[model samples]
Target: MSRPRTLTDWQALAARLTPQLQGNAFINDDFVPAVSGETFECLNPATGERLAKVASCDGADAEIAVRHARAVFKRGGWSRMAPVERKGVLLRLADLMERHQDELALLDTLDMGKPITSALDDVAGAIGSMRHQAESIDKLYGEVAPTGEQVLGLVLREPLGVVASIVPWNFPLMMTAWKVAPALAAGNSVILKPSEKSPLSALRLAALAREAGLPSGVFQVLPGFGHTVGRALALSMDVECLAFTGSTTVGKQLMQYAGQSNLKRVFLECGGKSPNIVFADCADLDRVAESAAAAIFYNQGEVCIAGSRLLVENSIRDAFVAKVVAAAERMQPGDPLDPTSFMGAMVDSTQHERVMGYIRKGIDEGAVLRAGGEDVAGPGLFIRPVVFDGVTPEMVIGREEIFGPVLSVFGFETEEEALALANDSDFGLAAGLWSQDIGRIMRMTHRLESGQVFVNNWAGGDQSMPFGGVKQSGNGRDKSHHSLAEYTQLKSVWIALS
Candidate 1:
């Protein structure tokens, strides 16, 4: 479906569909304020305008939500539902999501400052994730282990009771669905705590889940700071499993919380400073350059797996840098509601300041700024696509995950140097290498330390592929059949007949 582009057009659309302007934490199929009864303003980064007041939940709210989810799981209303029945509800939820894509997209755009086009893609991905998990629910099979002649052994996967989903703000609804769908498909009740920067879509999702026949307390949304509700969920004894997608620092803290509390199963998909390499023998330099720019600039570089470090072979270093710089020039800050807007504002003032600090560090480290080093002055929190050359591995910009639209360029003469430079980071979430040589591709594929490597492309994957990272980038997969196992526990049943 087509949507309005201009601000005036969007204002008219908003008047007709005011879409829960103010939202509260969703629990037991209803919306309610926190026990503290405090609220915070959700601002539009594009215009710095107050969109709505969101509930500021704390440890008190977390206690109530966890207990309710535990009760629901014990009651067998949802946890004991047949696989096919659970699949049906998830499918219906996807359908309703499709029906309300416009509203959801707008909410995401307003809440997170993502381009409307990007927000639409996020909604589509969220729907796809739910449907994919739904279809895989009943098809998943248990195992029959070999045993002695008189003994039979069977291994079954069972739900882990209550699960907590803590997702980041970059892909709000999609990330939530990636965790929620698989956990729910495994017959577990979920308590989702979305990033405080963007929690509107999660609240909306809970309402849709209830409408699609999800039993009370099966799915809940808590909107608050990570230190409060998120930490509470991590420390809860009743939450058997916790799935989190956010910063590496917070991921480590959650792991500690799990140990300090009930020692819950923790699955984390954390930060990345992914590398994008370009070889001299590449057939299409223009396409590679365009992809390189898109890789780092897309979504204001808020993506966890963004290719922020660009390594080009010395043979094509100058030419590739020029092409990438020109492409970066085209991505400028624009109104997120406008469909044609290619780039949007940062999520908030704090993130905006953080990106600026990185840009300054790059300049201070003697890296030459090829393009866009300053902020776009206006009512919104917008930064230009900053590209820096002459960056060294020891430089702060090269070593840190700036988490913004800032690219660091490096030149390597040999394949060995490129491999060394790419693997020099503490993160191993993802990496992108562009080379047509089959032997080179094979060599890099084997040697790269990252979890997911993209050959001749940037960060790209579907729900069918397993997605996760290693090392400081964190552990456990997010998508595909492997992810379903994260939420389920294995039980071995042995039978003997004499």
Candidate 2:
């Protein structure tokens, strides 16, 4: 069906659409169960209903997928395809994604408990990424190294045989495309392991890839747990590159797995305790307040780059925090199927409890509860947007990556103090500062330890920018041509002229 027009229309469509569960591991262009025929339950977090029985793939399943990926990579069907030819196939996949937008968006909303509106946005972003990476294929050129007339030196980029993308359930479709598009653009066979919490859209994506003319064994979707399927991929010699977007703990574990096995190249986009600093500058407080609320509350505050730590200058801290709390109050949790819902349930019961624990820890450690820190009494895994005022930099909530809609507010006196508070965390994925002073913006961006800095905004950025971080936030860029190039290896050739 076409894009639903009204809220009623979307809600009605969601009601009628049942998840046509794909509960098998895909390999060599076909679906197959684990050797033991094991399966696990997939629940709808918003309603706490069983969505499907997903495949419980293990090391055996990973072996099957990896073997097929290796065979296809060596055969050079996708690996050696002409750049223009590969571009067309990816473009066709993008078109198919557009055609099936409604279904994909619906699956993500139902599976992960994100608002339908945000699910639609994620689906659209995924399609755009596919198209953008496709367009870049033919435009890329190999370089001729500068050398003497007697020598001809050439440098070319080639695919790194097989890439395994391990994506979290937070924004399933978008993150999967973030890794898969670039890996495929570089002409590598890809094995995608979507989070067991939400694997429906990824399963459906594999079907679209085959429909768009991906050759056999070039792509597969394995739905399983991190310990089994994820660890297996990290340990598989056939899987050359592992790209992951998850927590710092799991990211570290995967790195160890890589070291224990084949020493495969691992790129991790992990945890963040980003600081959102607001100053008493000559600017609009209302805009800053709204942006600050959305930064920590968007996606139920499950964002990796969420500005969880808010450092406000002492002069304007009270008024600014009040306005921010008011903005959050207006954005309440609602049914994920409802189009008007800006906030939805946590991804699962475990996450809901984890968030509540952090909120309690903040209060125990002397941070004042400012607003809306209670659990929503309902069937779904929902928590109210929480704000902890009078929070110090040493508080657990201020230092840890809670990964929920919980904000820790801190007061700072001067620029030096603000920088110190922002850079004190072990994680440094992103940081935001609200200031009109151009000099201050430039200085903060330079001095702050975060990888991405936003002067007056938070989280929304162009795909052309390389996205990743240093420190415990993990390394390696995810988006842009830089990511596409990372999936490939550089080969240098030299010839001596007679």
Q: List the residue pairs that clash in candidate 1.
A: none
lDDT on C-alpha atoms for all candidate structures: 0.92, 0.91
Per-residue lDDT tens digits of candidate 2, residues 1-498?
567866687777766766456778888899888777999988889888888888899999888888989998898988999999999999999999999998899899889999999999999999989998998888899999999999999999999998999999999999999999999989999999999988999999999999999999888999999999899999998888999999999999999998998889998999999999999993899988999999999999999999899999999888999999999998899988788889989999899899999988988998999888798887899888899999887788989999899999999999999999999989999999888899999998999998899878888687788899889999999888888877999999998997
Cα lDDT tens digits for candidate 1, 319-406: 8999999999888878887777778999999999999999988998999999999988889998889999989999999999999999
Which residue pairs in model 2 clash with each other? none
The TM-score between candidate 1 and the true structure equals 0.98
lDDT of 2 at 465: 85
Report the lDDT of model 2 for residue 227: 93
